[model samples]
Target chain A: MEIKQIAEELVSLVREGKNKEAKEKFYSADIISIEGNGDKVEGIAAVYEKSNAWMSQIAEVHSASVTDPLVAADHFAIGIKMDITYKNGYRAVLDEIGVYDVNDGKIVAEQFFFKS
Target chain B: MEIKQIAEELVSLVREGKNKEAKEKFYSADIISIEGNGDKVEGIAAVYEKSNAWMSQIAEVHSASVTDPLVAADHFAIGIKMDITYKNGYRAVLDEIGVYDVNDGKIVAEQFFFKS
Candidate 1:
């Protein structure tokens, strides 16, 4: 699949609360996600755990969208503006850009940046 | 040139206050550095300006080293821990993983992370 399609699909699954589908679509077996915060979840299982914890706190992922999406070879990157509204009407504003390293149709690694 | 060599050289130039050499070595004619803090310096010239401001406030960049440096095709990325010591003895500890999207041998896009 084209990187654009992959990126959109993966993010869609995530925002739609399709956890299993998002993980299966977005990551490789050995995918490495370097958490933006030092508390990275190491591997896939850990990612799931952290994600579950997040879900436990928040009702859902409010929205995930990107702009300035650029693709070079096997990498796809974009600037993102997100709102993850919590259960209590409070929201966290995240302005970031994510870079995904893809290989053989799967994302093998990802890095995220948070705006200060 | 190996990305490892390039990463080390570029970072060294930045740390050593060799602005000209570092800029010459790492960026293209139209490089874009997303301020990691949202005040992105759109082009190479802007990058130099923001960087200058940083240096003006800080005494020096203490160190830059990467672990798990990886390269596939035209991209390079790694985890970083840095200390920027200010003239006033205050310091900022930046623990980040940067993913660089290189094109035609130059880094066109760079995303940075800050661990919470």
Candidate 2:
């Protein structure tokens, strides 16, 4: 699959609540996703743990669409707008820019930032 | 200047407290910066206003380095870590991915996101 396609799929899976599958399919053994942890998550085991935390959050992402997905030779960036519903009957809107490094048909690194 | 060089310079200008010079040097008249405002700031005037707000915040970005700056034909993503020390004796650390759209030798669009 094209790198862009994979990226789309990963987000799709997560949006669909298929967090495990999404995590499994998109990440490499040396995968590094710079997340809210303030540090990088390395290796499959670590990524799985990260996925667990990410999935357990009481939230629903109403929309996840790519805006201005700029693709290069081996890298691409996808800007996304996400409407998340929290457990406290509160809703948060998050806009994110996700930068990915695809190597050997797998995502090696990803850094995501949200608007607020 | 090379696109990367321009990117570096613009960021440098801002870091050095030369916000006006940096904004003047890098942005086009129709510049659009998708900032924390949740809406796009259009035109050079709007961008300048945005810059004013950005420059007014009391903070010190201890480190701003590019991590895996993926440069494509028209887009590039830079992951930046900022250590902001507020005047109220509070520190807010932000890790952001800034995506820029350069057209006609100037920044026509930019989007920024933080880890939090």
Evaluate all candidate structures by whole-model CA lDDT and list the values in order: 0.65, 0.67
Give lDDT for model 2.
Answer: 0.67
Question: What are the iRMS values of all candidates?
Answer: 11.5, 9.4
TM-score of 2: 0.48
DockQ of each: 0.04, 0.05
The positional error of residue A41 in candidate 2, measured at the CA in angstroms, is: 27
Cα lDDT tens digits, model 1, B9-96, are 7666655657578677878878867644545667888878877777788887777544544443455555566678899989886655
Backbone clashes in model 2, listed as residue pairs = none
Interface root-mean-square deviation, candidate 2 = 9.4
| CA lDDT, candidate 2, residue A85 | 83
Q: What does candidate 1's lDDT look like per residue over A37-77, in tens digits?
A: 53444567776776677777775566765553445445655
Candidate 2 lDDT tens digits, B1-116: 66678777776775676758977888788887885334787899987876667657766656544455545445557655657776666887665567777776787777765422
Candidate 2 to native Cα RMSD, angstroms: 13.8
True contacts kept of 1: 0.00
User: Interface Cα RMSD for candidate 1?
Assistant: 11.5
Per residue, candidate 2 scores C-alpha lDDT tens digits across A1-116 of 88668767776676676757866787788987875223787888987887677556846767655554555445557655667786666786665566777778788877665422
Q: What's the CA RMSD for each of the models?
A: 14.6, 13.8
Worst lDDT window (10 residues) for model 1 chain B? B65-74
